[model samples]
Target: MSTFRSHVWSSVGKKMITGLTGLLLVGFVAVHLLGNLTLFIPDRGHAFNAYAYFLEHAVHGWLILAFEAGLLAVFGFHIVAAVTVAWTDKRRARPVGYALVRNAGGKSRKGLPSTSMIVTGLTLAVFVVLHVKMFKFADHPSVVYDGKEMKDLYAVVVAAFKQPLIAGAYVAVMGMLGFHLRHGFWSAFQSLGWNNDRAMGPLQNLARVVSVLFAAGFLALPLYILFFVDPSVSGGHR
Candidate 1:
């Protein structure tokens, strides 16, 4: 009886952590997307830079650091748990690879969506590191670009997008991220015991909508810079 209770508690504990962490990540992504959207305002590079500067150096700097640390921990745990869950399921159903295998248990097969989640997560991680290096770490040198001695954030953004491959990569990764979140959001809610038949149905639909909106919002910045913005201005600073 004690062992049974322990096992039940452990499973519940893991699910609780997973659900909470997923919710935390969702909040972070929503706020990050909102901030990214600020770049869309024409000739507001200073505004965006100021916003970034506040996040990095304001009185709330320590708070942001704490939140980032928490996010990192949650992401690490989520990945570890996801891998563990996937491996365990695979082992339980060790079957030969067939052209098609269906699980009637309402579980998604190991297919494009699953593969894309892993791949895009990795790709986005790489992009994030590069993004920080290019934007955040770039020194603010006074340069005479279009009679402006400010940091050439506009140039940096345009230069990065000029590479068609990178722009396409961003779009692809964002698409995959949408798919991943479409399933993940509702799953997280369900795990947290918000799974009433009536409520869950509408919530699932809402999750899909929200996920696509988020993906579109994040993807728009690169697309705008790559396609619409005039690169010649400020030496390709969009």
Candidate 2:
């Protein structure tokens, strides 16, 4: 038991935890993006509202609460494990900075995405808190569709995106999310001992493709709301 506990706290073990949790979070993000895509449906938010209603009412909402609790725990664990690994790496580095800086080519996978992980991760952390507060906890006005009334979450989303400053910041943060995921997607594999010379290239390319799709997917929503979506639609006026 002691041996297991020690290994779990060790640098390698922490890194493994980070990798696993990161992949799990990535899965959640992808599903969430898919759900949010309903915002683009032309039915004046009916489709999006129905989606939101289903999630909330599924299994009488107990299942949703349990899943949220589990997700929160995973997020907490991922943050702690990642921060600990990064701190360990920093502490083990040479005290004095290197005199010369040179690119080590393919042998070194370091790049903007790799170096900026900490910054982007922390920034996204803040964004997540604000995002939840804005959309999840905020009071959403009710709307009726097909004789059923549900929270007009789609309206809240539209109203928020129509603001230039909010939309700009949202788009910028999504760009950072792309940079983070570009490295994180592949880095998770490397940390889990799944990467080798034969697989690294394809994994890296796949990571880049997924990152762009996610970032662009999210960025498109705010832009579409700002430019294409009329203010009178989706309760944006109220």
Candidate 3:
């Protein structure tokens, strides 16, 4: 039993952990995108402000803390597992492709994201840190609605997205995110033994569609905000 326990800490176990945590992250992204889509309400960002307020006030205390903590744990565990698996694969592989080869062919039949998962994943981690600090913790000016003070988070976000360079950077990151998700999604299923012969094609296609949607959906907000919406006039911090 002790030997079996030790063996379970090998390559397969690490990859299984990565797959499980990857699913958690996918779900988190979906929920975050749905919530953030409220920025398009065009009601001077009232809907989004109210939603944010609700999340902060009503959802405050230990419950929200626990949820946030759990998310961090999932992310930390996923990063550790993913890095471990990647390193282990690197150490065990022959030069001729007995293991991993992110860069092999010209067109890369494995696709760019699959080949660069570690890079993109780490890049996104940096993005997440900056993102949370900006929107989640940074002090910002406020807006008054019906005599009530709400964090001018909408304005803050708009201000950030309004920068051409910032907007471009965000869109580019979204592209990398799409690439990561494309490979991660199908690979998750494969790791879990769901990639049957008959299902592989459909699963891969579904992964592609989902990856594109996530990128497009997330990118749309910044594009729309920077181009179409006028935050100052739309009830943001004026």
Model 3 CA lDDT for position 145: 79
lDDT of 3 by residue, 80-166 (tens): 988887877678653122112222222323668788999999999999999989888889778777878888778777888889899
Please give the CA lDDT of all the candidate structures.
0.65, 0.84, 0.81
Mark the regions of model 1 whose C-alpha exceeds 4 Å error after superposition.
1-12, 94-116, 136-154, 234-238
* Model 2 regions more than 4 Å off: 94-106, 235-238
Ranking by lDDT: 2, 3, 1
For model 1, the run of ten residues with the poorest summed lDDT: 95-104
What lDDT tens digits, residue by residue, belong to model 2 across residues 1-238?
Answer: 9999998887767878888899999999999999999998888888888888998999999988998999999889989998888887788853211112221133566799988988899899999999889867888799887678788888888888989999999999999999999999987876676766677789999999999999999999999999999868664222
How many pairs of residues in model 1 come into backbone collision?
2
lDDT of 3 at 164: 88
C-alpha TM-score for every candidate? 0.76, 0.92, 0.88
Q: Highest lDDT, which number?
A: 2
lDDT of 1 by residue, 1-238 (tens): 9987664345444555556677788888899888877678776355555556567665657967886688778888776655554455458655222111222234443455545665665565676677668776777533333444445565666667777888888787788778778777766665567655566678779877988898999788788888887766533232
The number of the candidate with the highest TM-score is 2
